[model samples]
Target: MNTIKTIYLILCIFAISFLSRFWMSEWKWYAQFLRLKLKSKEEPDVGFDNKRDADPNKILQEADDIYQLISSTKPLFDIPPFERSTSAHNSKYYIMNPTEVHSTGNLLYTYVETYDYQGNRKTTGGDFFRARIYDKKTLTAAVGSITDFNNGSYLVTFPLYWEGTVYISIKLQYSSEMVSLIHRLRDIDNYRMGFRGIFLSKNYKEMTKCHFNLTFTGPLCDLYYHNSGIKWMCEKPKNLSCENLSSLEYYFNEPSLSEAEKKFDDRKNVLKEIRPVGASSVIVKKQGSNINLPKCQSHPLTYTNSTGFVQNHTWISSLCQVKRFRTSERVIQCIKGKKIYLVGDSTIRQWFEYLVKIIPTLSKVNVGRNQWYSEKLAVDLTNNIYLQWRTHGLPWHPGVPLMLPDSPSAVSLINNIYGGKEFITVICLGAHFTRYPLKVYLETLIHVRNAVKRLLGRSPDTTVILKNGNTRTPYKLLLDNDWLTYELNQAFVAAFMGMNVSLVDAWDLTAAYESAELHPSEEVIKNEVDVLFSYICPNID
Candidate 1:
């Protein structure tokens, strides 16, 4: 009987252990479900109708905690480590077809003048300000933040605050209609249509006695900084300073100044606007320390009179031709000692960077940053072939600093001088200027085409490849129910005379098979890179 009891006890213990394990798992699952339910409430709902257009960034941000945990275990799978190195190099391609759902109006412009602790002009270091803007309307396509303005300065004020000696400046580019709103606001008219919300960067949060001029005056005018939101009651002042005010209370009180005085005060602090200086200083991994200027290996191509300021040239002795869509080795051999180039706005930088990333490390690369001009990256080949990446003559987009043609910014001269080198040059110039009226397009392209003509002289052999707009997703559809890709391409292509330069259809190469329906997929990138290699180094099989 004792032996039987022992056996029965062992069986009972085993059964209890099994039951406890099962119950523990169920409890854990229940806890997970509850957490997910709570999270769903806080996270923004990504469009599920089509997964292709969903934003991976938003999804990743939501699951940040999990990423942190996994990151600690295996650094590779974690987002933080992967992001740090890549983010610096990450850039958008020119072919990105973004839809402008919001009205194209320059609605808001807030200019702030900086003063030091001694009440002198603080022009050397940086200044800080609070700023906020909202997307009043829902945008189907990906919305981009107005990161840096080309008004000439790179220091930007943010809406959020961070610890440290971060100095900030505010710059923006909207539409001319938006700029008009500021004028009306200063006149004491309706202000609702102008700036939607406020934005402030970390740089402003740490400042002490800061004085600035509020350029826009409106019926519902108020000054907000940190937790202090002050409504001004006095008549519009021409100039205002936070320096005299003993506390935040003074900014709330209406200034006892006249309109003319206010205008003068506002003008005193305003300096020249800032512009997007492009990538600051880029360090090519194994190639060199820093680039001095945009330079490349010059390929010899014939100068033909094209519609633009570039020349068209091809290999005199051919290697091979396209056969059943398959490239022959002979065709590859013909492209020896030739270099191609792409120059345009930030979006074009994306396409250019992607090409740079894939090229074999054995190839030579150079990266440079200039204070007055755009960032540059140049690659040299074993042969005399050299390729250059530079952006010049970007037309002003409203709310953003006007890309003044006179402001040491024009590609016409550079292209002409560079043309002396006998080589193929493929140029990409689009976006970065829709805010300017149609006249801006005509004027800008005329200079561009003229530069091409001056460089190519008069020849058919020089190939001036013009790229079309990239494909976009339906989510990017705007109020007009049309994509800017079609419009932008039409405008640019129409401005060009195709006789001398050839147009390489990039829309198909970059965005043909993207599930996002906007940015190119990895596969698409590979294909585009392949095409670029074929054009630049046709001799390499």
Candidate 2:
């Protein structure tokens, strides 16, 4: 009888202990949730007027005039004058000083010098230059930095990634071109810039004179100008625009000049002579070398973290493993029983488009032709998975159809989400707001942060990811250049600090690549998606 009584007592104590631990865990989670909620409440409220004062017609006209100026391919400024030296000079105008071969994960430096037509040294302090290293065997490439000393010298550094012989290429930016870039980065009212290149269809190649403004959004250029007040459309071409657009090589090619003209060698004269000539090769040893490579880790954002290196190509995250859902079955398995909400700009739309193409059964049901901001959905009924995409509220490009009353803001969308282990939400915003004041972007982000905090509070198990803006190729007329995007990305990182959200550092990934494309190439997008999936399924390989 005593043994039975003792057993009962022991069982009673065990039950109480188990309950105590479970309740304690719940209490801690609740405390964190409450803290986040209070922090969100403390954020300042931001509001925007629904009515805009600008006329779309005038903007479109200005865009047309700017397009004509850029297409003419004329120099925007006069060349600088340079005096020819009587003494003999180095025949090689520019010399690339080579550095020792490096292994994977090591930093390699390549130095360059700028000289005039007479072989006299020239200063490129104000000029912008970019360097790239191309792997000979894989044909893959990585971008490098060119730090100018205001003298005749510049230092270029590359983070060695691949093995084998690597060829280096340097592209220099003219001072006049630098002015346009600076304006695009700083000036909020500059609507004349931002068109990178025109897209052309094989069948409609005859349409050369097209005016592009904020309202143009079709894949093919349309002739209708009555309603929009713009005759030409800077359409997003269905096929690759590489063939229709002018190549970088053509823009930066060495200009042919008379012998007498070459002898003068002023700034104007030197500009014609200066070009990115071929340089010596640098070898990168294989990945298994004895060199101690730094392991990539995510650091918490703090006030003291330096923003200077945000644009640097060297700070790449190595933790991202390549993930490919090559088959529809694999995608279905990964996304099954999950609800995903993708909110942001056309860049996020790219992800939606990629999935639609890969998954044969995932058909897009068109909500309406005029409803560009409407919710787009793709469902796999058998797996019970739901995917949705919607544009975030206001300051979006005029190209997007105005939102309906039913449309929700990013904050509202996040708040509406019944977050759970099965829910994933991605927020991406930047390119559209580059032309607006910096304060506007920050206000929007604060509201978004509040919404995210509230959602996480309600459903602590929910996953939220933020995709930062990517780099765009440097084009004089392109308003949404890389420098502006880089600054906006910095603002984005700042706004989301101390929040429980995952950041896919697209800026670093995009800048590190050989291509400075606004809409990065498929290889880059694939890597981004893979990184995203890594967060979604960390337990998977």
Candidate 3:
């Protein structure tokens, strides 16, 4: 009788353990159904929808228990956008340390005074002022650093590099008032852009709208993609259940800001060049040897006072020796028998397009073409070369419909990669995420950072590069301003600071080249890729 009792007890324990495993396996579907109940009227209570996006444990961690690793700006001005929109036309600058002739090794400063479009002398400062010192004859250029006093004054500092007829160009992109408003708008208009939801069943198929906020008056489906902590909801099909929901699509809608609000963003009046009362150009003589650094090798890319500058349209990096791989033979010889993955916005896609355009041996695979946000692949089979470029996950507004099932964050892609010495991954993310909340972008960085850590731990030889955001035309206003990109770049720098990744200072590269374009000229992109090749074929002669 005792032996019989023991056997029964063991059997009961075994059955319970088996059932527990099954319960966890159904956690997602069961949890969704349990929380969702069709009721008498108001939108179904999907309060747990947010919780569903991230793991319960992850939510606690995402509460941010780790050490604070990112540094960013919080715009100081709180006045309305139109109330004190800065006017570059009314701003003026004069030399701080005036001298007959400037010496190469010294630093010089210029002070600026700002005024509002209303002609009121501004008392607080948030002017996005940019300055550059360049000499055209020698083809020498460098980006200057600006210091804002928050008291309606700015100090522009220039380091004399190559001497001889250097012109100072100062551009006041946006005043503090407009920048503060732009910052506020980002937090307020999270759903200014909308998305499409597609669902299907055996005998029923339906298409409806999906978004962070829904207006439909009926049943809704809580959508979750693989392991991503993003909240999305769609209208349930009239005939089919929530389980039939399939994919999501994203695109731009009309601007959410009112005409009154639009007054703050006067694109036509943006980024006026300001000149000094006295001389705007200076004469300088040579001091140092341009700080010629060692060739770009497998080492991490670091930044100096002059991270890099444009000389005769060539990017000279103080951090590494940047080599120009201008021809196909040079590129193919260096990258043959390798796999290159480029991921990010259209800006990064330029790299993919550049490679295929220049390398005659490289023919694009049938992955599709000319779409801004499509996944692309090109191959040079003879040399065993593989290249692919895909846009980063959501918050992405591809002009055309993007299949949601295929959309993935850099973190998702990195997590799935098992790399070798020949495997190279270049990631550039920021322009797309600027419109969302800071928390969302931070969450993305944390996930990507962790994913990168895992990837390196698994494959120590794999190369990972993080390209920072750069200057863009200020005329694009609220969403496409450089100030927003600057904040994102700051967070990016801090998150990837200590990793084994190469942080290309694209900010310096584009600005030094004086490219106000988000998609800079081909020569600029070519120089950018040369920086990439500096890594792939490090220290190449």
The most accurate candidate by TM-score is 3
Candidate 2: stretches off by over 4 Å: 1-99, 112-128, 145-155, 173-181, 188-279, 287-317, 368-371, 398-401, 473-478, 497-499, 508-524
Model 2: per-residue Cα lDDT over 1-541, one tens digit each: 5654554455455544433543464454435434432443345322121121023443333334322321222222333432322111221212232334567776565555565446666653444444566654564566665444545555566666667787665654333233333433344333433333343355553222222344555554432311112232344455555346321010111333345434332332111222433335766788664444332222332222111111222332443333555567877777878888998877777788788888887878776444445678888787877788977755444343232332446766776798999999999988776664444465566557656766776787888888989877534223445545655775676566556667777765665564567677766676667666656765554
Worst 10 residues of 1 by lDDT: 308-317
- Candidate ranking under lDDT, highest first, comes to 3, 2, 1
Q: In terms of TM-score, which candidate is stronger, 1 or 2?
A: 2
Q: Who is ahead in TM-score, 2 or 3?
A: 3
lDDT by residue (1-541, candidate 3, tens digit) is 5654554455445544433443453453334322221211145322223233244455434424221322223444445556466788777776654454678767666667788777788888667777888888888899887665557876677777666788888988776766777777665666666677667676566887776557788988765542235555777777777676665667555456666567766776666797566668877778656665676655433323357678897887767778889999999988999999887888889999999999988988876543776678999989899999977776676666566555666667777788889999988888877777655676667656667767777788888888888888754578778888877886675445435678778898888887888788998889889889887888566
Would you list the rank order by TM-score, best first? 3, 2, 1
Report the alpha-carbon TM-score of model 1 versus the true structure.
0.35
Ranking 1 against 3 by lDDT, winner: 3
How well is each residue in 1-541 modelled by candidate 1, as lDDT tens digits?
Answer: 5654554455355544433543464455435434533453455322122232123443333334222321111112111211111110111111011111212211112222333223333232111111222221211111111211212112221221111121122222211111222222322322211112222243332112211222444422232221111122222222333322222211112323344323322322222222211211111122223223221112322211111100011111111221111232332243345555556554455655554454442243534333223445545354344555556443322233222222223344334444423466666555543322233334445445555655565433455555555554333111111123433454455444332444444443332221233445545444344444444443343
Tell me the whole-model lDDT of each prediction, alpha carbons only.
0.32, 0.53, 0.70
In terms of TM-score, how similar is model 3 to the real structure? 0.80
